[model samples]
Target chain A: MRVVREIALHVFKESVRDRVPYTLVFFAVLLMATSYLLGQLTAGQEVKIIKDLGLAATSLIGLFIAIFIGIGLVSKEVERRSIYNLLSKPVSRRQVVLGKYLGLVLTLLVNISVMVAALYGVLAYFWFVSDPSVKAGWETPALDPALMVASGLIFVELALITALALVFSTFSSPLLSAALTFGLFIVGHFNADLKRFDQIVASRPVAYLARALYYLLPNLTLFDVKAEVVHGYHVPATAVVSAVGYAAAYIAVLVATSVFIFERRDFK
Target chain B: MPAIRTEALTKDYSTGFWRPRPSRALENLTLEIAPGEIFGFLGPNGAGKTTTLKLLMQLIFPTSGRAEILGRPVGDVGVKRRLGYLPENPYFYDNLTAEELLVYYARVFGHHGSEAARRAGELLDLVGIGGERALQLRKFSKGMLQRIGLAQALLNDPDVVFLDEPMSGLDPLGRRDVRELILRLRERGCTVFFSSHILSDAESLCSRVAILSAGRLIATGTVSELLAFGVGGWELVMTNLAAATVARLGLRIARATEIAEGHYALELPIDAAPDGLLRELTAAGAALVSLNPIRPTLEDVFIKKVGGARERATFHHGAHRDHREKT
Candidate 1:
């Protein structure tokens, strides 16, 4: 575990010193522009647009961060032959996999946290300064507590994709890993839809395949609470817990599979 | 117990993606190095020196046989903690400064906070890279990278250190420094096993060396033992021998060159005695400036052993000989 922590911290340090987190600057600029431009909407809808756009941007940026950085975690070391030195240490392959996974998770968490904070800061201005007439028609206050619930779930979604990217990175090229991870992310989002595809499709073979896939692919939409948070609807405590638990289980399996492959690999 | 030992250690790599073909990279490599010995793994490129080192370091699994360090299996964590390895053409995270990279490795070895920092500083200075400790690795030259790689390998004060092609990118000065460093490690009772194609470095540094060729262990023995394995021939240098006198002995002489105005260098067979030649030269009004027996160098033995390994050079118990190429 100590080895895992050391490797994880080193990965985090590497990502920080690299240009990976420089994307945060882009996020900051986009937020400012989002606030100024989206303000053109009718007063009440303007706040709604900001909230919706803010959450959407956070999720999108987090997806990019998780996929891009996570895909390089192990593959970069292998490609550069740096893994030779690290693996020579007392560290286990499993520790390396876990450390890299958590490291990218740390990077994603920090980036998302900043975006979440900036989004709320934009909403805070509207909360304190908006016209009473606009506030009256608002379904929720600009600084809604439900935003935290939504942000946490968004992080959970990103963490799962990070683990998936890491597993692909253990055996594949970064380009392929990114493509596969992003491909899975797209597929996972539509996994819940696949359940009903069998009802809409004509062929029995296709319906059976869809039925099988509905259980295999992640139901990523379970973590999305953007609309509910924007409209002041309740996000159940059970749903948030369930999403977090599902991510944890998925990450465990992915990491184990990564370690299994890494242990058998020959760094030729 | 030997500090390092491998019993029939072999590795076969599969080439091609669709229809994989097994290619033997190392085969039946059996070796041992006692404590505190500077052992050199000498081979030309593609001769499986790196593969053997990689096998010892456990960077790759062996297809058959086994290797042990400190009398523990290769997978033993406690044993691993007491070992260190530097791979050929080492690379580190490009964004890390020399200091941070060392500190990170130190922490991996279980040192904490300031101790890790202190060790990092100490190792950087030890490897003569302290001045560049603040510079990122990507900004470093090849020599600087090699030095940092050595620093990291020795960071743990391991009982045994394996360095693959340690001289790959070092300048003569850097090579000398590394040679001295290896000597220091021996003085501290640490076993240093390093691989290289640079025979000169191996000749000057190793107490013993194994010449590997064609993925096979061709020979292994002490420097003196290898040199003594075969005496190539003797070289005779002389001056004041007239062309008329040289012509008279041309039938007896193999080949003669006028190295200077009147000086001649000659090649003699291993069985030839300089006494008879000296008598003839002295009677012919020639002065024998000096007479000495010429012995084979490590490179000579290396070439012979490498050639032999390729041409059914049966390994007898040591670094071997078909003799030397007489000049």
Candidate 2:
């Protein structure tokens, strides 16, 4: 466990020095700020626009960080031949996979936290500047704690994407890993549509194949509470628990598969 | 238990994309390295020297056979605690300074806080990188990187140090420093196993060496035993005698060449008694300069063991045994 933590801390330090995460977070903050200005032009629906754009920017930036940096977490070491130094140590292959996974998760947490803070700052500015006497259609304050539920689910989504990147990275090149991970992320979000196709299509084989894929690939849409939170609707506690549990299970399977592949690989 | 042992260890790699062909990297290598000695693994390019090192380090698994280090299997993680390895042209994390990198490696060995700091400092000085501790690795030269690599390998003060071409990217002075460091390890009773194509370096340091040719163990023995096989003969220097007179003597002289104004160099077989030659020279009123035995060098033995390029191209299994039997 100590060895795993040491590797995790080392990887964290390495990622902290990398500029990719910082650049993505900076752009997300900029987008959040831009949404504030864009909100005024929408009039009356300014709060909803700001909330929707803020959540969108946060999720999009987090996805980029998870896919870009996570894909290179192991592949970069192999390319640089630095894995020789690492694997020659007393740590097991499982520890390396776990450590890198934990490390990238930590980086995503910090990055997402910064973007969330910036988003709240934009919402706070709106709350302070808006005139209550104008009598807008909705009277609820834009700064709601309920939005955290949306952000938390977004984090879960990013974590799942990060695990997907690691699994591909264990056996493939970084470019292929990134492409495959992004493709899976896209397919994961639209899994419901694949199931809908199964019902609409008359061909039994195609429907069965589509239905099988829908069950096989992760259903990431369950984790998205952005629409509910943005419209000031309550997300059930049971939904949050199930989504978090799903993310955990999928991440475990991905990481376990990664460790299995990594263990049998010969660093020639 | 032997400090290191291999039982018919072998490795094969598949090449080509469309039509994959299995290329043998190491073939049925069975060898043992005893404790507390400097052992050199010598071979030319593509002789599986590095492959052997990698297999022993568990960076790669063998296609067949098995190996053990410190009485544990090669892939045993606990065994690595007593092992140190420096790869050929090693790469390290460039974002880290020397101190930070060493501390990180030290932490992997379960060292913490001030103990890790102290161990890092000690290794920095040990590898002659104390002054460069604050400098990031990206700015370091190849020689400096090699030194820093050596430092990281020694972070745990391992019992058995495996160095693959430790002197590879270094200047002569840097090579000497590493050679001395290796010697120091031996002085402290650490088993040092290293692989190198630098025969001269191996000749100077190794107590025993195993020479590999085309992935097969050609020879393994003490330095003196291997060199003793091809001792050329005895050499004699004489002067001041007519060529006709020397020819008239009928001694089995191999060849004679004039050295300076009157001195001549003479060669004879190992069995030739020098007393008869001395008596004959004195009788002919010639002066004697020096007589010394000519022994083969490790380079000569290595070339003979590896054979010429033509012979190497046709190298096959059981060839090492044929050469051994003939010798």
**Leading candidate by TM-score:** 1
Candidate 2 DockQ category? medium
Tell me the number of clashing residue pairs for each predicted model.
Answer: 1, 0
Clashing pairs in 1: B220-B319
TM-score of each: 0.92, 0.91
Worst 10 residues of 2 chain B by lDDT: B308-317
RMSD of 2: 4.4
Q: Candidate 1, chain A: TM-score?
A: 0.95
What lDDT, from 0 to 1, does candidate 1 have? Answer: 0.88
The digit string of per-residue lDDT tens for model 1 on A1-268 reads 8998888888889988878767778877887887777677465787788888889988998898888888989998999999999988888788888888888888888888888998888888877878888888888887888999999999999999998998899899999999999999999988988899878989999998999998777779999999999988898899888889988898788878888998899889
Query: What RMSD, rounded to one decimal, does every model reach?
Result: 5.3, 4.4
lDDT of each: 0.88, 0.87
DockQ of 1: 0.81
Local accuracy of candidate 2 as per-residue lDDT tens digits, B213-316? 88889899999999887558788888886677667656587777767755778888777887888888878888777788888888898998888632865664
